[model samples]
Target: MLVLGIESSCDETGVAVVEATGPGVPVLRAHALHSQVDMHQAYGGVVPELASRDHIRRVLPLAQDVLARSGCALPDIDVVAYTRGPGLAGALLVGAGVACALGAALGKPVLGVHHLEGHLLSPFLSRDPPEFPFVALLVSGGHTQLMQVDGVGRYALLGETIDDAAGEAFDKSAKLLGLGYPGGPALSRLAEQGDPEAFKLPRPLLHSGDLDFSFAGLKTAVLTQAKKLGDGLEARKADLAAATEAAIVDVLVRKSLAALDASGLQRIVVAGGVGANRRLRAQLDAACGRRGVRVHYPELALCTDNGAMIAMAAAMRLQAGVQEAQPLYAFDVKPRWPLQELAAA
Candidate 1:
């Protein structure tokens, strides 16, 4: 079965084609992505309306490119899958409208996939795909969560952020230091030059037990430190960035290990944009390695929101018989849908 996926949840417009065979991991024939980062960079962040317009302009061409590269035709696509929410409503509608329109035109069933589920299942597309019954850490711009994933549709939320997510902490902290838009990467890059112990940033909820996370206080601390640095802030920005990265990474690594110990699951899969953080990956690798626990991550390219993950997710859902694509062209999106709600789907 050939599953065509479309992703326009936020700042990226992605399209991909995946072919599923029997009961194995689906093969990604081809995938393409167009990042709106440069466009949104001038505005400091994503403008939902602009994101939606760009998706309209880019999705189709990306779809065509994926089809051409994959050596597949529109008629050969067995199902059309799209990221259906927990994102900007306008952006979500663009992909949904296009996907549903395509499905209607091609006489194929369409599936509305939860955006986070795509992130969670993305590792399956990697060269070393993980097996079932592992813990998953999903850290992204809008969310940070830990889940016990037993299978394609069996996800149990173990913990999550109560306030600002880890990605938000990175971006917001970087913004405080005058970093440009899409600040997380900027922050991480600068962090490489400074001492992780420079500014003594806070590591929120590092010891409250349970598995919940909180980073809002950490962002506030960064703001306070930035103000205290005054003119020196410019010179010490790298140090501050390193400090902030350290604090966040410390909490995440600790909490992840705690989650592993509590669940008795030796393997953990990290996904979403923050999962692309080199510092996080290094720290997790070292920590999990010392404990003899295995860790997995989506390929860096797939770590961000992308069509490949969505197609892979849809294919897995179908293979597991947990859900089926529908012929209904009428569709709606859930901008605030929680991953837990997906367990009921």
Candidate 2:
């Protein structure tokens, strides 16, 4: 089966095609993505209305691009899938509207996928796909969660962030330091030049005896430190960035290991945008390695929001017989849908 997927849950617009043959990992035929980073840079963050408008302009063209690259015709599409929730409502509507429209035109069945599920299942598209029953650490834009994933549709929530997620901590801390838009990467880059121990930072809830994470306190600590260095903030920016990154990484690494121990799962899969951080990957790899645990991550290209993950996730759900593509074109999106909800789907 050939599945075409659309992702417009936020600032990026993505489209892709996947081919599923029999009961195995689906193959990514082709994918295209257009980031709205440049567009949203001036505003310091995503503008929902602007993002929705950009999706309107980019989705179809990206769809055409993916089809051409994959050498597939519109008539060959078997299923049309789209990220239906856990994102900006306007952005979700764009993808949902387009996907349903295409399904209606082609007489193909339509599937509305959970956005976080796309990120969670994305590792299946990697070169070394993980098997069932692994713990997943999702560090996406505003979400930080730990889940026990048994299979395509079997996910149990282990823990999640109560306030700001890890990604938010990075971005918020970066903004406080005068780093421009796309703060996570910017701060990380600056962190490479400074000593992580240069400034003391808090590791929130590091000893809470649970898997849940809290980065809001860390961001607060950063803000306080930044203010204390008001006169010489520019001179100490790199050191502060490094210290903040170290604090966040320390909590994550320790908590992940704790989760692994608690679940007794030897394998863990890291997904979502923050999973792309080199520091996080390095720390997790080293820590998990020492504990005789295996760590898996989506390819760098798939780290961010993308249609490939959505398509792969939809195909997997069908293969697992947990869900079905419906002929009904009417759809609604859940901007706050939880990943655990799919456990009952």
Candidate 3:
């Protein structure tokens, strides 16, 4: 089966094609992505309306590009998949609308996929794919969660963030440190030059005795520390960034280990944008290595929101017979759909 996937959940517009043969993992034939980071930089964050408009302009061209690169045409598409929700409503609508329109035009079935599920299942596209019954640490844009994934549709939510997620803490703390938009990467780059122990930052809910995470308090602590540094902030920016990254990585790494113990799973898959963090990866690698645990991650290029994950996820679902593509052209998007909801789908 050839699946065409579209992703316009936030500031990035992506499209891709995946081919699923027999019962093996799906392969990403081709993918295209256009980031709105430069466009949203001036505003310090994503403008939903602008994002929606850009998606309108980029989605089709990206789709065409993916098809051409994959040596396929419109008529060859078997399933049209799109990120259904848990994102900006306007952005989600763009992808959903386009996907449905295409499905309707081609008489092909369409599937609405959960954005987080795309992230959770993305690792299968990697060279060293993980097996079932593993833990997943998802630290996407505004979500941080831990889950026990038994299979394609079997997910047990172990814990999640109460307020600000790990990604939010990284971005917000970077903003507090005067880093521009797309702060997480910028902050992480600067952290390479400073001492992570230079500043004392709180590790919120680190001892909560549960898998749940809380990064809001850590952001608050960063703000307070920055305020105190007022005049000296510039000189200490890198140090502060490093400290903030350290604290966030600390919580994520520790909580992930706890989740592994609770689930009795020796393997863990880390996904989403924040999964690209160098500090987090290094820490998780070091920590998990100590316990003889296997850790998996999507290729760095796939760590961010992309169409490949969406297409791969949809292909997997279809292969597992867990979901069927719907012929209905009409659609609705969930800007706040919970990943756990798919457990019952």
- Collision pairs in model 1: none
Residue by residue across 243-334, what tens digits does model 3's lDDT show?
99999999999999999999999999999999999989999999999999999999999999999999999999999999999889999999
lDDT of 1 at 186: 96
For each of the candidates, the C-alpha root-mean-square deviation to the true structure, in angstroms, is: 0.8, 0.8, 0.8
Q: What is the alpha-carbon lDDT of model 3 when measured against the actual structure?
A: 0.95
TM-score of predicted model 1?
0.99
Off by over 4 Å in 1: none
Q: State, as a TM-score between 0 and 1, how close model 3 is to the true structure.
A: 0.99
* TM-score per model over all chains: 0.99, 0.99, 0.99
Worst 10 residues of 1 by lDDT: 336-345
lDDT of 2 at 243: 96
Better of 1 and 3 by lDDT: 3
Clashing pairs in 2: none
Model 3 misplaced stretches (Cα beyond 4 Å):
none
Candidate 1 Cα deviation (angstroms), residue 317: 0.1
Task: Specify the highest-lDDT model's number.
Answer: 3
Give per-residue lDDT, candidate 3, residue 135. 100
* Candidate 2 error regions (>4 Å): none
